[model samples]
Target: MSESIRNLLEQVKNGQVSVDTALLKLKTKPIDDLGYAQVDLHRVVRQGVPEVIYGAGKTGEQIVGIISSMKANGQCQILITRLSPDIAVYIQKKYEMTFVESAHIGYIGDIPIQKTKSSIAIITGGTSDYKVAEECAVTAEFYGNKVERVYDVGVAGIHRLLQNLERIMSAKVIVVIAGMEGALASVVGGLVDVPVIAVPTSVGYGTSFGGVAALLSMLNSCASGVTVVNIDNGFGAAYMANMINHIGESK
Candidate 1:
């Protein structure tokens, strides 16, 4: 059983909660059907993380309604990825949220306090990859893990990455965000003992095939620890990294 459920049972035993109320809380439906959205209320209980809103295809009103449903179900922190500034403005009228333009993320509620001593490192191949790197950083931090950012360290200038060897080596998990040939993942994977998640962005030229080339390159990485996510999928990379970073630690 989850800690929250155990605490609820304890409250019932202590007479702090009425039996009917406890039953109602326990019997709460895992999915809240909100017509347009079926919000997963039991995700936190099952996965130790809440369901995140993918804001790209959603309108402001739909997003607001989902947020309302989540809030009503006692979910405090919400993460919205690929959110636009305009839609953020519309949602801001209803609830306070921090919108990060670079990462295109909207966050509701306070970032959780760090949960573990080990950290996740977010490394980028170039300045252009900062957008993806920021997305990984924000998602990792929101999940209560410390993040170290190492930007503009692609293989083109091996010295730049070499300079941050300490930070790279110390991380519990590392996320490598890069475009073009996406060779950074292999390089970093070869260097770090920890897991390396590679993200390929659509920032390269025509021959790059809109990040497909990078995606393939990363998929074929020779480094043992290297793993690849979809093109421009920073959130997925961070989510996996968070799980690895939090291994053996309490949620």
Candidate 2:
């Protein structure tokens, strides 16, 4: 901070600075326009959260710009979800210490890393659903949550889900991704006491309607704890799960 800014803060501490003055200092926290990128730096200060990079539409350069800006202050862990393999490659080459899984949905880190014995499991109904499940796991890991994945355990093979019952039920939260009829979420919901964030992926054929059937099925889940995100929204599911688990970790 400059001498002027330091004096301003001192006045605020001494009760001489009006609320308006405090507002001005806090207002500078967010949204830095870098022409190509508009960074939301104030999110962490204002909302107790940091901005995330939505990696699907933007070029590798734009993502680099956003994540690099978040890393500038060295406070918040940066996350970029829905990163394609090509972009992941570019990011890996640029940021040497960061992990770039070609199959991963994103990356995570900042300050003292968060970890918990209380785990979050990413569950998927079928092999085709692995990508979304991977995304959920990666994003959760980035947020400092310990994550486990239970893939290819949809209702088609009741035995598979049955095999992992202990792990699934024990988790703090379960993110279930599925396509086809999306019956897995309802089944998992009925069995587990914890929250189930249902993710509908565009993984099935004709009647699946690009996961619409699965999305509706998840929304209509008879199971009480089931919550559904948009079709193919693994990132949204993970983000919500992090928010829910964040409280427990802090306690």
Candidate 3:
């Protein structure tokens, strides 16, 4: 059960709230109907994380409406992915927002402090891949995980990657982002003792086929613990890394 439901049940057991009152609280509608969208209000109850807003196709007004509803319902923090700076600036006028231009992500509130000792390391193969790496770093931090960033450490120069051996090996979960064949994932996977999440970005020449070549390369990685996410799916990789980092924590 969710903490909210557990607390409500405890109140009933202690006679602080009547059974009917408890039942009413439990039976409240699970969605917020905003005409354009029916936001899932009980997602945090079902999963540890709450719903995230995808801002690519959403209008600024629509995003504001959804955020308003969530705030009214007591959600303190909100994450918005694939947001443009123009839209983010418009939204920021109404609410405080931390906008990451490179990652194309926006946060309405401060990230919660990490709850675990295990940390997530985000490594990028090249300078071109920093956008995707930043997305992974911000998402992991938002989910309450300490994140370490190691950038421009692709296979083209083994020395750059080797220099950060201690940071790479000590991380509980590593997110490797690369393009142009995506060999960095396998390289990092070989070095790290923990789980490795590979994110292929569309940051290469014509032969890269907008990250398809990298995607295939990652899928066939020889490293045992290397797992691959979809092309440019930084959020998905970070979410998986966060789950792996908090594996032993009590729900």
Query: How much is 67 displaced in model 1, in angstroms?
Result: 0.5
Q: Which ranges in model 3 have alpha carbons more than 4 Å from their true place?
A: 1-22
Off by over 4 Å in 1: 1-3, 6-23
lDDT of each: 0.91, 0.79, 0.90
Candidate 3 lDDT: 0.90
Q: Model 2 — which ten-residue stretch has the worst lDDT? A: 96-105
Using lDDT as the measure, name the better of candidate 1 and candidate 3. 1
Rank the candidate models, highest TM-score first.
1, 3, 2
**What digit string (tens of lDDT, one per residue) describes model 1 on residues 92-209?**
9999999989999999998877456899989999999988889889998888888999999999999999999998899999999999999999999898888889999988999999
State the lDDT of candidate 2 residue by residue for 44-100, as single tens digits: 664555777788899988887787787784444677776777888888787743554
**Residue by residue across 1-42, what tens digits does model 3's lDDT show?**
556677778899999999999887667677999999998888
Per-prediction count of colliding residue pairs? 0, 2, 0
State every prediction's TM-score relative to the real structure: 0.93, 0.82, 0.92
Model 2, position 167: C-alpha lDDT score: 87
